[model samples]
Target: MSFVIRNIDKVIVGDGKVLSNADIYVKDGKVSAIGAGLTVPENVEVRYGSGFCAMPGLWDTHCHVQSSGGIWGVDKDMLPEAKAIRAAAQAEPVVLSGTTTLADAGCDGNISFALRDTIAAGIVRGPRLLICGYMIRMTGGRAGKDTEGEVDGPDSARKATRKMIAKGVDFIKLGATGAVSSPGMKQWSPQLTLEEITAACEEAHKAGLKVHSHAYGDEGINLSIRGGADVVVHGITLNDENLQLMKDRSIQLLATLSTYKAKLPYLDKLPRWQAVKHIQVCELLEANFKRAVKAGIDVVAGTDSGMTFNYFGRSSRELDYMVEMGMTPAQAIKTATISAARSFGLDHETGSLAAGKAADILLVRGDPLADIGVLGKAGGVAQVFVAGRLVAAFDECGKEIG
Candidate 1:
């Protein structure tokens, strides 16, 4: 399919640049050209972009699509088929919210892989999915009861990494610290040792896959950095040394801020231990985030969606938090666009509006450059295209339209 978005008010190039009053020509599921007065074939469809702001589709680096029911309601015992169905149901809302690419942080069994493959095969309507089949953790680590990748020593961790690769995972998710959701575990309790983490990272790197380490405390964060993790997820208790190590290693931070922020209104509904941990983390999040930014760390946007009150389709709110913490509107947008693509090694294909890139484009009603919050507002996203195909279109009232 081929089409052209004519007279776009502005094109956010996703790399801190914008093209004004340009025409975007898309053909064969990729951007053909981006310039004024671009001519197209007679059979191509042309859509008016006069009222819309064009930009690269958003990216969510940390998401759990298979886990739905929130905190107390999350049932780890759900049948595999049921989990897959629920995940499939959640994909549309995510794509419609302007996210064209996302990484499934972890999933039960092989549900994430199935969802990703089905989407690739056109059997499902969703964004591009990169998934880690199950998060590797210590035997008694966080969420051990929910996932199957629990290991103990370096050998065990190496074997677990190989198992995930055999399962055809896109990346390896390592649990370096305990989590807030686990009732018996303290959030700061370091779980995986440096040796174990190194084993897993080495195995994953050898297979040409990135390692995303789930860490919260200083010890875990430092261990992950020393272990050669490609990206550190959460990173709540970052110290100066950790920051220096991360900078020296070129490791990006995927701060899932929305998850902590989303828990505020529902603190009363959470378990006492969980609520306390959430509050503590929320208190430190902004200060630590600002510090990381000031220290010149590369930050990526992720909402930890599908967890507690952090629902899907609200992923763009992470950008608002980023701007509020320190980043400018353009910098925050880059974190979710070009920066995110670079993190996933997808910069060569889709991150921005270029002459030869996947047409993963988002059209919004207002200028996101002036107000980053507009991207999170209702009825803000007017259209969403993935691989040059219009998968979602919303009316002025935020209702889905043909």
Candidate 2:
């Protein structure tokens, strides 16, 4: 099957440049050719996105569809069945909203990937799956205080990484610091020492995979980077030393501003002791990100969607927050399109609208370069193509097959 989308208002190309009055050709699910006014071949699927703007489909670097946790709090027995249901619900709004690739945050383990496989195999429509198996944690580590990621030594960590690799996980996740929700645990508190994180990263890399660590403080950030993590999920609090290390090591950051936005309304409800912690996180994130940009560190746009106070699939809001934080609209788009793919090492395949890449693209209604806010508006996607298949049309929900 082939498609020749003609007369697109603007085709946002790979280098973050938009071509006016363009046409795109797709064959065998790869972009065969893209130019202006090519002679249309008979019998190819043709569509006119006249009032639309095209760009690479949106990508969400961080999200958790389901795991042993409820919508807002911990749900210890997050069975595969429950996970599948939640993932299904989560997949719709994202796909319909124009996202094609979404990276699952630290969820699923060797013990729970069949559920992920089921969601991938079934009728769910959204981003392609790239998931971290169960989070690797130290005994009484950061993720769940009650339910410990307690691996005894380096050997145990190695064994756990092997199990996740054997299960065919896309990457590995390690919990490096205590989180806000985990009561009595302070943010930036290091959970796994250098040796443990090194063992896990080495084992995963040896098997030709990458590691993404959930770190917060300077200690956690430095240890994860030194251990050779490909990306640091959310290290909001960093000192000059850690910032330099991150820049020197070339580790990317997934700054999740939306997570903080969602928590604002509940500030009064938080325990007196924890109230300051939330405020501190918000302040540090804004300040540290400005420093990261100044230091030439690559920062990707990621919304920790599905966390407490965040919407399920509407991650476009993150782009708006990025502009408010000092990134230009073009820079914010680049973060999601180009920089984001580099973070996952998938830049060669799906990041931008380049020839020979997978035809994962979206058609928004206006010029995103003028205002990033246009992407967050409803009905922005006129159509969404995943691997050359017009899975969803404008204002359409699911696949439309005859």
Best by TM-score: 1
Rate residue 299 of model 1 by lDDT: 90
> Largest lDDT belongs to which candidate?
1
Q: How far is candidate 2 from the true structure (C-alpha RMSD, Å)?
A: 2.9
Off by over 4 Å in 2: 67-80, 108-116, 143-149, 270-275, 395-402
lDDT of 2 by residue, 1-402 (tens): 888888988888857577988998888888888889877578888878688888888788877766322333445566656767766777777777677777776664332354456546755666676777677887766444343245667888888888878877778888878776555678779887888889999998888777888888888888888878888878887778877888888888888878887777788866554567778798777888888888888888778776666766677788888899899888888888778888777888888988889898888777888888878776566677877777677553333323
TM-score computed on alpha carbons, candidate 1: 0.96
Model 1 agreement with the true structure over 164-234: per-residue lDDT tens digits: 99989888999899998777888898999999999999999899888999998999999999998989999
Worst 10 residues of 1 by lDDT: 68-77
**For residue 205, what is the lDDT in candidate 1?**
88
